[model samples]
Target: MKIVVAKTAGFCMGVRRAVDMVLDASNLSQEPIYTYGPLIHNPQVLEMLEEKKIFRIDTIPEKGSGIVLIRAHGVPPEDEKALKDAGFTVINATCPRVVRVQVIIRKYAQKGYSTLIIGDQKHPEVVGLLGYAKGNGHTITSMAQLLALPRFKAAVVVAQTTQDTAFYDEIKVWCKTHAPHYKIFDTICGSTEKRQSEIRRLARENDAVIVVGGKQSGNTKRLAQIASMAGKLVTHIEDASQIDYKTLSSARSVAITAGASTPNWIINDACSKIETNLQKLHPIKAALFLLRDFLLKTNIMAAAGAGFLTYACSVLQQTAQSFHHALIAMLYVLSMQIINNLFTIKSDKYNHPQRALFYKKNRTYLWVLAVISGGAGLYLSFITGMLSFVILLVMSLLGLSYNLKLVPIISKKGQIARIKDIPGSKTILITLAWGTVTCLLPAVANHSDLMPVAVIFLFAAGLVFARTAFFDILAIQGDRITGKETLPILLGEKKSFDIIKYALIFNIGIIFLTVFTDLLVKRAFFLAFIPFIMLLLISFFEKDNLISGAHKEFIIESSFLATGLIAAVI
Candidate 1:
């Protein structure tokens, strides 16, 4: 059995330094030693340290006489002060890269550059950087939100040491646009870039790739994402023992990569297991595996299309008046065909063959479903009333325009493409559509007063904008890669983040005004608004990732649906 290891395997500089510092302090310390947190990301390493009588403490103990080591992820200044005040002997194992972030932040603050740290606010490194800035720096996670900030002069941009390099570049460009004089310090560690690039290269070449690291380690998770983008079979694992041998039984070649904190032994153990499993598979079985993979991919596409159409039906039913209104519904269905075609054309040449195939295979059935439904909808609307028919026609056009030739006209002209590419467009469009369909479509079809309709549209627009901006923050990378100019890409991460902040503030203001204007039933509507506020709070802390993005959409959609249901009942 042969084992191949990635060139960048094992503990990185920060992890190495932190581990060594802890061991050295343990050797010399007389009192029982403790780490402020896990000294490194790897649980194996922490377990070993615990065996040696080293332990973790969240805060300085009451007696506080033991040697207290700070983790590679530096602690906030106030916490460090509290530890020192408690009479603990402190050993600072803070990574050099993280230290640089602290220095840069302090420098910017001293120079009066209204400093901004573009990173996760809850992250230890980010928390430390903020403390070092001493209340002068604002933390931003995306560029679109940053642009909406009250204009600041002499802004200096820095990132969390583990942040994506491309995101850092996007933030720099955004600051250049909004700030009078902007300075960017590329503070991301070189090891992170090297590891990410290496994983991408491996994923492109390998049949399958395993990214081994702690789930909580940001850098390791990024390596997994790079592998996913290359369209390789990637599994992220915390240790060698967690590897599912059954999944790799037929794999001929598998590449292994680890995060900054992963130990060399773990990588080696996983590789050995992979080779042992492959040896047990026969040639015929391997061929069977490939066939199984193909069938699974095909089934997945069919299932997805069916699911989407079902959801669209539910949405239409909620908005439309009667079963006879199915003709207008048919148009809505037809519009989906146009969207599917546009996506197929745009994505066919991408490296992910599975995605292209999925779109192509399901497109025919999707189109048929759309056309039949749309045609039926139009005929029913005409039979019912001219006004209802017109509304259906307009909606069908809007849906088609979003993805087909009509929307491409905006893309080709550059102005509209640029605007849509801006971070907030998708969120803005989806939310607005939901709100409009829920509030206005029913009234217009029934010839109700326009005043209530106008109020609903306005209120819905505000909430939708808030929700969409947050999702845009999550999709910054996809938008950048696909050349879909979004707020995060155009304005940079920090600026884009500030824009979301301002948007939320404005949204809250509008909600208050609507309350005073009696647009909402004071108590019932306000109670419903509580969930949205909670969603906003959750979005603030969300890490920019696919799971978080999905979660954000789920929360926003639920809020929209709940608000609509509550309003309808009232």
Candidate 2:
């Protein structure tokens, strides 16, 4: 079975802003934080906010304290003033598109024109838009209602930011024919229009459509309603648990989409659940899927890649094959990667739903395994030599402290924290660690010359850096939400990709240059081509729309296996 995910399925710009605002407030505010209402219509997001102690207040308190954020659906100006008057700090997170509608209404209202809003009257966005009309606002959901209304001498028409485009267009036709003198503005948000358009295309292409979002969200419900009009089997589910496997199993292809307020994690979960259910229908496919998932979840593929990289680096140093060094590299990376995943599961909730669930379910067992692997790796390092053991031990300690708060807090406002908090540190640290273990540690144990090993270290680090940064680019949304300062987030996606591209090109160039100069073994030059191949694969994955997330990950990880294969052959 084929599963297609809409590119515009998850949170849109406005919803993302609201969520980021609330999360930042929760993280930075010393005082309790409260949103004037539920930040968005998604219940899963509300639960997450509640978990962070960011509550919602439906009513304005007599004496408010701490910070109160305006919802994504803008509230009335008076309510905002009331919150301020009640002694609460207000951070308005209203969608800028909605604000544009408000501004249009206010501007025309000042000229004595009444306001006509095309949307559900009770929606928070419409309610807020109404406040800008200065007592001359009316709402109609359909053309018949607009036809029944008394004709206005002068009026401005607008839409709730998430209003249906076709319905609003029909209203536009009615007004053009029946009330030509009235002013009309297309206030439906661009993001909303794009999402609706994408879903329509998805519905046409797939046998089954799954809409994931909050049931109460107006835009979400409208998506389901519109999808139903396509006559395809459509399922509107709040999360993965509600998926209708019976319906999904019979379909040849399925399309997954989500409302503007939905997060990537929810959409990812829904997709993963459907795929898992479909896999169970065939024993061979199920086994293969399980094996692939197991290898990824346990970081075994990544560890194998590390082992391969170690082999390549050793060849560069003109050293004989050392399975012991490779094994140590594999175990050390597996330990650190698992522990890092354990700490980063929050971001993974959005970035990698299946891995997040795996870590959650087997938390204790995985932690124990990480500790044992780390200890065994260190023991093997000690057997290799005192220098290898000390270096590995120090790196292990640094890895363990990556997420721990290390900086002292001098005051309430002054606190330096975890190494993870440092801007663009994740990619750099990961690259350095991988380079040290795979190249430097082994080189030191073998008593190789410092200069040659340093050159080899740069080559190894460049490969890992490109890989880590590319994943970070794919995971930008989740990392931003979880307040991680990864390289992609700090530098932006396009720049990060450009950096990765150049880094890959540089690695390839250096490797070829060394080979031509006879600075290292001729066989090692073949390993350099590995990054060039990876560059092509990564470039292709970015450009291809049909490639699934799992396929992309597997292909990227498999790129490193070429190193081991070529080293063994040569």
Candidate 3:
């Protein structure tokens, strides 16, 4: 079986903008936050917001407090004034396309034009549009209803932003022939149009179509309606659990698409479940997938990568007993990475659902592993040398304190009580820690000369920084919702990617340069290929997303093992 996912699936621009606004507001202030109604039609998102303590108010009280955001579907002009009159600070998160329709209706209503809104009468957006029409408003859902209305002397036609484009088109044709004097405006949102168009093609090409979204969403329902009209088997589900796999098992190919309000995680989860169910994998393939997932979820792959990179760095610097340093690096990284994932469960819930579940179930065992690994690393460093031991101890203390409140005397107005609150701190701290374990500790232990040590440290730190920042770019959505000001969120994804690519390029250059300066063996040039490969992977993943989340991570972690391979070959 094969699965084809529509690229247009998932949250549209207006939905994304609204979600970002609400999340940003929740992150920045302690005020009681509320959306005027459900933020979007998706139940999962509504549950997440409630979990974050950002609730919604369906009604306006005589006196309100804190902040309340207008829904993405928007509300009437009078309701906006009422919320302000009720003493709530209003943030208009109304979809811009919906706002455009409101503007059109308001402009013409003042000129005594009856507004003919082509949409479901009870839908939120259409109701909002009706408000702008004052007393001169008529909503028609069918051609019969459109014909039943008296031909107004003066009228303006508009649509609900998510209205069915084909139905709206039919209305336009009828208006053109029967009421040539009436004015019609093309108001269906571009996002909606593209989604409908794509679904038509997918329905024709695939054996079955799976539409994921809230049933309440007008656009989502329309997608299912359209797919069924295409004469293919269709299943409209809210999430992965609703999928009726037995019915779909007969299909050779399936196309998956989601509504504008549906989130990426939900779609990803559904796709993963569907694909796995259909595949019924062979034993070897199943084992490989499980092993890869286990290594990533336990942070073992990442720690092993650190160990390999440390060994390669040790070789470049001509250190004695490089294996001891590699063991230390692996232990320290395993400990810190485990603790980091534990504390980041909130973000992980969105960014990595499977890992989040694993951590939640194995929380106690993970804590024990962190303690054992951290203690073992310190003992190894102590036997190596006093300087290395001291350095590792201080680094461990900092790692432990990363999520803890270390800054004192913070007032309620200031949320900067933890080191994690500082923007871009995660990437910076991760780089320094990795560099210290992989490069600085080895140098200090062996008493390497200062110049060569500095060069090796730069090479290690550059790669570490690039790796951390690249993952941050991937997790920006989850981080923003969970209120973590990571490097990508601070500088934006494009800028961060540019910086990461540059850092990787610089690492390759410096590692190669070390050979010319007599700082490293000639074989150091081969080790330079590690960062160059990473640069290519990052570049490729950015342009195309052929790889799934887990497989992509496995390949990236495997890149570090390449360094060890090259070192062994030489």
Candidate 4:
């Protein structure tokens, strides 16, 4: 079955702002952080926040300390003032869109104009908006209510931001005919309008539509309402486990959309669940999918790629014909990759859902395996020489500390932090580490000439740099949403791509240059084509959405495997 996901199916600008603020606060603040309410309607996010020790307070205490954030749904001006007056450092995380509506209402209310709000009468946003109306606030849900209210000499009409556009249009029509002089502002959020319209299109084109979000979420529920109105089979689910395969089994195609407050992880989980369930009916296909996931999830494919690159690099450096160095490289890479994945599961939750789940479920086993592999690699390095042992030992310690807090209280206020917090550090550090293990360590082991080894190191590091940065580009969306300042996020996607492209070209040139100058054997030249092929594949994937998710990752990783194959033949 084919599955389509809406581009706008995750967190809207406002919710994302609030979530990012909270996450940033989590890392920076010494005081306990609290939100005025659940940060957003999505339960998963709220739960995650709770796990991070960011609590929520439904009612204001007479006195409070630490920091408190207003949720995405704006609160009354007085409530905000009270929170600050109570001595808590207040960060207003209210949606800018909602803040605009409040400013309008407050401006008009001060002029003695009655304010009419169009939305659910009880929603937090509407209630907060009502606060700005001073005593002249009124809310109406429908045209009947609008028609029943007495006409005002002068008033302004606005919406709850997430209000239904069509319903608001009808309200506007009633106001135009009944009271033409009243001011009107279409305060419904543009994102809400786009989401509603997109769901309508999705419903029309697919056999079934799945609306993924909190049932309590107004915007999420409206999406379901719109899909139902379009006469499509609709399922409203909060997460993946709630998906009913029996209902979706007959459908040949499905469209998945999530509410504005929904996070990407939930959307991915729901899609993965559906795909998994659908594949289960055919044992052969199910087995294949399982194997593919296993290879990628366990880091086996990545390890194989590392081994292959080590072989190619060894050949380029004219190293001895022992596989010990190659084996050490593979084990070192495998250990680091697993440990890194375990540390980065939060971002992986968005970039690679299945791999995130794999790490989540097998964390203990994976941790043990990483320790064992790392130990074995270090043992082999010891066998090589004292220098090799010390280098690998120091590298392993640095690897272990990569995610640990290295700089304490660099800021005026102390906070838990690490080298990972440094922008663009991940790509550079991984490239250096991989180059050391795959290129530098091997040369040290073989006692090779410094000049050729240096050239080979550049070639290896350049390719690894290009590959890592490209993956960073592909994951920019999730990285940006999660507030990770990766290389692509810091430099922007287009510039990052240009850098990767040029770096690949440079790597190709160097490979050929080494061969032509008789610095390396003729067979080493073929390895240059490996990166050339990768450059073409990346360009193809970028030009057209030719591949995505696991498939794209598998094929890119296979490029390194292909390097090993070409080297073996030559």
lDDT of 4 by residue, 1-570 (tens): 767777678789899888878877876788999999888998877776776789999988889999999988899999999999888999999999999999999999999999999988789999899999997989998778887889899999999999888889998888888899899998999999988888888899999998999989999999999899888889999987888888888888788899999876577656656656767777886776677678878988888888888888887777785367878888888898899889988767765677888899999999999999999999999989889899988777767666776444242234556667677878998889888988888899888888888888888888889888987876665665555678987887779888888988998998888776767778788889987988898777666431334556778888988877777777
Displacement of residue 403 (Cα, Å) in model 2 is 3.7
Q: Estimate each model's TM-score.
A: 0.48, 0.91, 0.90, 0.82
Identify the runs in model 1 with alpha carbons over 4 angstroms from their true place: 1-3, 177-180, 249-252, 282-570
Candidate 4: regions farther than 4 A off: 172-180, 315-326, 340-368, 379-389, 403-426, 445-456, 462-556, 562-570
For residues 1-570, write the lDDT of model 1, one tens digit per residue: 223457776678887778767766775466888999777777766666776789999756666687898888898788888888899888889998888888887877887777778888888788888887767777787776676566776777788888877778788876666563777888888988777777777787777888888888778888888788888788899865677777764556678888888764455445544444454465664454344334323332222222232222223234345333322432443344345443644432222233345557777865665566667656766775777678767766655555545544444335554223334455555555544443444556666556545654555455555555655554443333334455565666667566666665665565566566654445433533633473466455443221222234444444544543444444
Off by over 4 Å in 3: 173-182, 406-416, 508-517, 543-547
| TM-score (C-alpha, index-matched) for candidate 1 | 0.48
Clashes (candidate 2)? 0
lDDT of each: 0.61, 0.84, 0.86, 0.83
Assess candidate 4 and give its lDDT. Answer: 0.83
TM-score order of candidates, top first: 2, 3, 4, 1
Compute the lDDT of residue 103 as modeled in candidate 4.
Answer: 96
Summarize candidate 2's per-residue lDDT along 1-570 as a digit string, tens digits. 778887778788888888878877887778999999888888877877776788999999889799999988999889999999999999999988888999999999999999999988999988888889999999999878888889999999988888888899998888888899999999889989988998888898889888999999899898888888889999999998887688778888888888998886677556666666777887787777777778888998898999888987887787754678888999999999999999977767766778998999999999999999999999999999899999999888778768876443233346756777677888998898999999998898888888778778988899999989987876676777667888987787779888998999999988888777656777777877788998998887666534455656767888877777787787
Worst 10 residues of 2 by lDDT: 405-414
Worst 10 residues of 4 by lDDT: 406-415
lDDT of the structure predicted as candidate 3:
0.86
